[model samples]
Target: MTIQVFLPSQFTAPEIFPVIRDSFGTFSEIPTEVDFEFSNLRFVRPSGIVFLSNVARYLHRSGCRVTFSGMRRETNCIRFLDDSKFFEQHIGQAICEGSSPRSTTQPLREVRHEQSHNWLRSTLIPWLSISSQVPEHDLYNVQTCISEIFNNINDHSSQDVGSIFAQWYPNERRVIISVADFGQGIPNAVRTVEGELSDPLAITRAFDNEFSSKSTPRNRGVGLFDLKQNVVGRFGGRVTVHSLGGAVEFRNVDGSVNTSTYNVNGYCPGTLIDIELSTDRIEITNGERESFTWI
Candidate 1:
C-alpha cells in the first residue's frame, strides 16, 4: 500500500539542495520499498529523477514512504532539475508530484461551537437517520461520552492548540476518534496546585475517585470519570491513559487492570483521547457519519 520513486546519478548531487522539515507528524518514516503486491512508479529522466527524489523525501518526512524508480534518462531534464536545485533547498519539494494539489486561491471554511462540545455535537446531528438500533438514545449516549472528554480537554488543556480527528467505519462497525493537544500535560496541570510531584502519583490521583486539581470549580471533575463509565460500564470497550511517565488501562466487564511505564516518555505535553464505538446504534454530531449507512 505504498509508492516508490527511483533516482539516477544526476539526482544525487549533495551540494545541489538544502534540507527540508515537516511538522504535523506527517514526515517520519522513509520506506525503501512498498508492501503492496502491485505498485506504481513514475519514470523520469535526470530532471524527473531529481523531482522524484525531492518528492519522495518530502513524502517520507510526512509519515509517508516513497521510493525513486528511474534515474538514467536524458540530461536535459537532469539539467533542469539540477539548475532548479541551485536556487532553492526545496524547490519542487514544496509541492509533491501526483500529490494532492493545494488551492491557495480557495477560501477556507470555518466551524463554530458555541458552548457546544466540539466533537459530539458536530458528529451526532447528522447520523440520526442511519441507525438500525438505539437511534436517538444511542446517539445521546455517544454524544455524552464525546462531550465529557471534549469538555475535559477544553477545561484542562489548551484551546486552539489542540485538535480532534475522528473517523467512522460503518462496514467494520467501528468509530475511532482521537483528541490530542500540544500543551502543559496532566502532571504539569497538577503541579500548578500540588507543587512538584511524581508522574505515577499524578496519574494515580487522576483516577483516585475523590481526586481533582481544579481550584476554580468544586466538582470532582467527573469528565474523565464519566468517560470511563461509558467505555467500561456501558459499552464493552476500554479506556487508557498515557501520561506523566506512566500508562494505565481500564478493562471491560472482566474488571482487569494493566499498568506499565516501562518506556513511557515525559509528560505527554499533549493528550490523545481515542474511542471505539462498535454498536450499530451509531450516533454522531455531524451528518457525515450517515454517508456510510449503505454498508
Candidate 2:
C-alpha cells in the first residue's frame, strides 16, 4: 500500500520533530510507495530544510518509490528549496520537470571531509567576507569552529557523509548553517563510555569540555565546547543540536547564556547541528590564536 504524508507549514526543529516522526514512522511496514505532500509548507528554517532533505535521502536510499506533489512553484519557499538544490539532489528530474532549472549559485550544498577544508577556506570564508563583511580575524575563528564541527563528524559520527545548508539573510544580517549526519546518534555513541545515561543528559554532557567517547590520550573532547564558545559566546549566535530523542539549544540573549533542553517524542536517527550567526553581534578579539588541531 502507498503511504501519504503531509508536511506542515512551519518546519523547524523540536516543533517539527513530531511531523517527521509520524511521516517516517509510517515506513515500518515497508510501503511500496510514499507520497509527500508539500502544498501547505510556507516557511522553513535551515534545520527544517535539512530535515526534509534528510528524510528524502533516507527514503531514496531505502529503495522506496517516492513522489513529491503540491509544491507550488511560485511560492518563495519552493524557490528557496529549489535554489538550495533540494529537489535536484533528492527528487531529481522526475518531479522537477517544467520547474525552473536548479540554480548553481545557491549557498546550500553537501559537504564531504575531503572537500571540507577547501569549501570553508575558498567558498564559505569568501562569501561571509563579501556578504557580511565579517572581519578577517573573526572569520578565522569561525572557520576554526566549523572545522572542529566537521572533525567531530569525521571522528565520531562513523558516517562519512553529511549535509550542510547555509543561507545569509541580508535584512537580518544573519547567516544560518545546518550540518547533519545519519550515523549513530550522539546519545548512543556517548553511551558507549558513559554507561547508562538519559539522552538529554548525554547531550548535555557532550558540551562539557572534558567529555570524549574515545579513551585515547589526545582526545580532549573540546570540539563542542569550543564551538559553543565561538558561536554562542563570541558571535552571539544560537546553536541547537538534536540527537536521538533529546534536543539542546545554546543561545546568548541580552548578555546572558541561556540553555534549554527537552525531550522529543521521536529520535532524529543521527544528529543535526544548527548555528545562527548574526554579523552585527560578532565579537572581534585581539587574543592570541592557537594552532588549529583536529579532534
* TM-score on alpha carbons, each prediction: 0.50, 0.87
Output the worst ten-in-a-row residue range by lDDT, candidate 2. 97-106
lDDT of 1 by residue, 1-295 (tens): 3442222233321111111111112223454443211112222222222222333333444566433333222434433333333112333341223322122101111112334455345444234224323445346656665665555555575343334334345566655544444335566666777777776556545655535677654345355665666665566565655443444555564553333333243223344445555664233444333221111
The true-structure Cα RMSD of candidate 2 reads 3.2
Residues 1-295, candidate 2, lDDT per residue (tens digit)?
7878888888665556777677666335556688878899888787877776776676777788888889898887887677667777775542333544322223456787778878888887777777777666668877877776777677666556678877788888888888887767788878988889888788878887867776672436457887887789877999888987888889997866678888876658678898888988866558445565655
* TM-score (C-alpha, index-matched) for candidate 2: 0.87
User: Residue 85 error for model 2, in Å?
Assistant: 1.4
**Candidate 1 error regions (>4 Å):** 1-119, 122-125, 128-134, 194-197, 218-221, 253-267, 280-295
Q: In model 2, what is the error at residue 25, expressed in angstroms?
A: 3.2
Clashing pairs in 2: none
Say which candidate scores most in TM-score.
2
After the best TM-score superposition of candidate 2, give how far the Cα of residue 168 lies from its true spot, in angstroms. Answer: 1.3
* Angstrom error at residue 70, model 1: 16
